[model samples]
Target: MTARVLLLGGTGDALAIARTLGPQHVYSLAGLGRVPADLACVVRVGGFGGAEGLARFLADEAVSLVFDATHPYAARISANAARACLAAQVPYWALRRAPWRAQAGDDWRMVSGWAGVVEAIAPFARPLFTLGREPLEHLNEVPEQQHWTVRCLEAHPGHARARIIDARGPFTAEGERALFTESRIDVVVSKNSGGAATEAKLAVARGMGLPVVMMQRPPLPDAQREFTSAQEVIGALDDYIKRSSNA
Candidate 1:
């Protein structure tokens, strides 16, 4: 029997790896954002319930290897992938992009959780949040002294003191600067989701001399093999496919 691969993906890097997969491989998503229609591999949407369900799927589908190309902050799925792969006796590989580091003149305030974020931003009158939809949940709790500008994948009608900007990135530095200027953003709140796509905001914040409240990344389970780049993972997967075919 041919060795088939299972790819757990949601991030842009995951999509890059998924594009390289063939008919025997499967790309699984958690049913958020846009699903790609154009791929040689099968696309599976929704959750596998948890580790037990995922292990069952791996066995039922005869998946020989599992590649996790999820977002840096996606600790739960990453943990689940590790557990499921172990249970199914399959090799697990992961692609984690390097996180962005603070530079000179960058006023980065590292925070652990939502409470820490709230405390850090308390002094600022106008705060811009780029931490996905987490802020949306607390729209009702907006401080009387502050106005919030939230940017996420989906647009929502914000409350009196908050406005939502629905956007996708590789945001340009110039555009980010314009946004900060127009919104009069005193502070920026974000997660250390390291990638060029959203790194423009950090540069703009640095140039404007605005403080940034950064959320710490969660710890993830270790994979059998870990890659820093998608190209490296793709190369390794290709080598495995070739060797399996020859065997």
Candidate 2:
């Protein structure tokens, strides 16, 4: 039988890895919500309950390997994955995109957390905010903004009432600039998700003299190995699987 790999994936790179894995191994997403209709294999939506729950799940599924390709900000879930895999004595790998560096002319304001952004910058300008939409409690704290533009990869959950621009990216600097210009956005608030895909807002903010409240990514625990690109991730996964299976 093929090796059973529990892929904790929810980002762009995860999509690519899923494509690469194809039908060879049993695949699953330790995801945040209900399972997707188009997914290829099992999807363990939300958490594994916790480390104990996840450890039990891994044992029951007989998952041979674990790959965590979650968004860098999902540190808690990442930790849970690592812990569960460790309890099972299964090899695990972490693949993440590095954060973008602050550059010249960028009027970037850093915050410790995403909720901090919603708090600090909400009073400043009609902010463009939309990375995750679940914890929207902060938006209520600043209801007086001239406008609040939000975009999402998934359909609007009927949970927001802001200026909507439903789309996904690697957002383009040029398009983002146009968006800011059209909306007259004077400030931005976003999570430090890293990668060029989501960093367009930073470039646009720099060019436009607007300010940004950037929430810092949470600290990641030390890993057996960490990789930046897909190729390295693939090699590391293959090696870890070999060692784990043989052991």
Candidate 3:
């Protein structure tokens, strides 16, 4: 029997790894995005109920290896993946992109969670929020005077004081600079979703001497293996496949 692999999709690294692994693998998406990227592998959308459901799916599919390449903020899913994989006695690995470090000229106030972001941005009226749609609900507590310029993949209906820029990322520094200037944004609020895709805004903010309230990444569930790059993940998965074949 062929040893099947399951990839927790959503990030660019997930797509790249799936492309390398070919059609034998299963790519699972959370169905959060309005339009998910089309991939080469067989794609499964939505949740697996929870940890037990995921374990059942892994067992039913005979998945030998699990690769979690979901977004950094996807803490619950990641934890579930880790638990499910362990329960099913399958190898689990997480491909986490490196966190962004502060550089010279970067005025950053690193925060632990969403509440910290509210406190940090309380003084600023014009704040550009790049933390995505789900977390925007937390901002309802903030006063209406703090108008937000939110960038997200899908349009969120909740924020009355927010001007939603319905767009995806991998944005350029020049483009971000123009946006901050045009919006007259006084502060930038973002989660530490590391990678070149959405980091240009940070560079632009630094250049403009703007203060950024950067949310730290939540702690990941302990995995048997953890990789930082697509290449590393690909190599590891390849080795696992080869070993399984020999076994």
Candidate 4:
């Protein structure tokens, strides 16, 4: 039988690879955003409990290989995948996108957590937060003097001190410039999620000479095989499936 593959995915790169998979392969998601209805592969939404549960799933499904293409910040899921694959004795591969590096004109401040973000943004009155829904949880804690503009996958009725924008990316530099100008964003709060889709904000920040409070990436477990690009994962998966079938 050909090797059955399990792809743990939530990012754009993961979705790209999922399009190449067949019905025998499984594409797993955390169900945070819109689930694709068009993929040829089996789409499994929600979680698998944890590493232990994932190991059982691998064994039950007889998955020969697993690919992890989750967001760069999704360290927990990646760690679970590594542990589960190890326990099941299945090949584990990860697609880790390269992070955005600071340009010459960019003023970037790295923060480890929410507290650090609060501290870093203390000096700015109008801050644009692109760090997702985490900021929504802290809306009650917003300072009386400052106003926050938050962007995430889903929009919510924002607090008096906060304004929320719900949108997806592949954003352009022109749009980002307009947003910054209209909001009077003095500083930007974001994660270093590298890719073209959301990168326009960084360039706009650079052009506007705005400081960015960047969240540091959490440490993730090392996979058996790690690739940086979607094409690399697809090529390897095809080769692995062929080898498994021939065996």
Encode model 3's per-residue lDDT on 45-83: one tens digit a residue.
889989999999999888888999999999999999999
Model 4 lDDT tens row, 1-247: 7789999998888999999999999999998889999999999999999999999999999999999999999988999999999999998989988999999999999999999999999999999999988999999999989999999998699889988999998899999999999999999999999988999999999988999999999998888888988999889988988888899
- Model 3 residue 33 CA deviation (Å) reads 1.8
Q: Rank by lDDT, highest first.
A: 1, 4, 3, 2
The digit string of per-residue lDDT tens for model 1 on 134-171 reads: 99999999999999999998879878999899988889
Tell me the lDDT of candidate 1: 0.93
How much lDDT does each candidate structure score? 0.93, 0.72, 0.85, 0.93
TM-score against native, each model: 0.97, 0.84, 0.93, 0.98
Off by over 4 Å in 1: none
Output the TM-score of candidate 3. Answer: 0.93
Tens-digit per-residue lDDT, 1-247, candidate 2: 3477787877877766665563435445655433445556555555568878888988888787778888888888888888888888977777877887788887777888655666676566677875576434444554654557776655554334366566768889889988999978888877878876778888879888988877787887566677887677866666655675577
RMSD of each: 1.1, 3.1, 1.8, 0.9
Model 4 / residue 47 / CA error / Å? 0.8
Give the TM-score (vs. native) of candidate 4.
Answer: 0.98
Worst 10 residues of 1 by lDDT: 1-10
Better of 1 and 2 by lDDT: 1
Residue 176 lDDT, candidate 3, scale 0-100: 94
Model 2 residue runs over 4 Å out of place are 22-24, 30-46, 157-161, 239-247
